[model samples]
Target chain A: SQTIHQWPATLVQPVGSPLSLECTVEGTSNPNLYWYRQAAGRGLQLLFYSVGIGQISSEVPQNLSASRPQDRQFILSSKKLLLSDSGFYLCAWDRDRGSPLHFGNGTRLTVT
Target chain B: AQTVTQSQPEMSVQEAETVTLSCTYDTSESDYYLFWYKQPPSRQMILVIRQEAYKQQNATENRFSVNFQKAAKSFSLKISDSQLGDAAMYFCAYRSAGLNAGNNRKLIWGLGTSLAVNP
Candidate 1:
């Protein structure tokens, strides 16, 4: 069975501070990883996705960025946090195209 | 770009009653997949059901099922015997079957519908 782990289950940061949220998957190799932000009523927004090592694709232009350093490790980072950056962030992984993505528990980040 | 639409922002249902959440999508791609995900107050998304564009039979899981109209491009989720535990945000998602190296495998999401169950 495959499982995903996301760190810093909850985070609070002052404005203009750096941000780093990590995600790692177990029992899978070279899986497609994705990062999404869920805001109340607006739905889950796709922030970033990676197909392979060191390959990252961004969906919407924002203050955040994502990287795939290893086959099972993915990181979401930001140089400086904005108030609008605060939301429930999720990490997901899928075996291939058209497959259902398995998600991590998620990390709640609040930028004050 | 493909788009998924969930018109109902919110819905209320009595316990033991059946509720249907509607979803529609627009896409030019012939091969694709539609999915329904449930997000409870805990904020974690779970797959409720899935429907392939080529499957004629609707998919069902326990109390959950889908009414898939491929020609109409509509996928609606029906929850039987609604429970208080079922109160949550439900999202409709779409994915393309064709592999695009540049586009990758991404899920196009709907705005979501808030389902409220009354005891």
Candidate 2:
């Protein structure tokens, strides 16, 4: 069975701080990974996705960027965070082009 | 571009009753997938049910089932014998099967409906 590991389940960061949220998949090879953020009482917003190592696509333009340094590792990073960046961040993985996404437990990031 | 719509923002159902959550989508592609995801207080999205575009028969999972209308472009989730554990935010999502850049099987989601199961 595939599993996604997302770190720092709850984070409180000051404005202008650098942010690095990590996600990794186990039990799957070359899986598609995505980063989505959900604001309170709002729908999910896809921030970034990666099909393979070093191949990252930005779905929405924002203060965040994603990178796939390794086959199973997808990282969401920000040079300096903004208050608007506060939200529930989730990492997901899927494969074979059409499977429904399997999500991680998610990280609650609060930018103060 | 594909989009999903969940008409109801919130709905309430008493225990052991039935509740239906409506969803409709706009798309030009015929081959795709529709899904209903439940987000409990835990905040992790869990897949409740899925419907394929080609399958005419509705999909079911234990107590959960979908009313999939291809021509109407509608997909509704029905929860029978609703329980307190079913109280959560339900989201409808659409995923295109086409292999394209940006498509990457990205799911276009609807603003979820908050489902409240009353005792």
Q: Candidate 1, residues B1-119: lDDT per residue as tens digits?
A: 89999999999999999999999999998888899999998888899998888899999999999999988999999999999999999999999887776543778899999999999
* Structure candidate 2, residue pairs in collision: none
Cα lDDT for residue A83, candidate 1? 96
DockQ, model 1, C-alpha based: 0.75
| TM-score per candidate | 0.97, 0.98
TM-score of 2: 0.98
For candidate 1, what is the TM-score?
0.97
lDDT winner: 2
lDDT of 2 by residue, B1-119 (tens): 78899999999999999999999999999888899999999999999998889889999999999999999999999999999999999999998878675674589999999999999
The chain A TM-scores for the candidates, taken one by one, are 0.97, 0.97
Worst 10 residues of 1 chain A by lDDT: A38-47
**Fraction of the real A/B interface contacts present in each candidate?**
0.66, 0.66
lDDT per model, in order?
0.92, 0.93
- Which regions of candidate 2 are displaced past 4 Å? none
RMSD of 1: 1.1
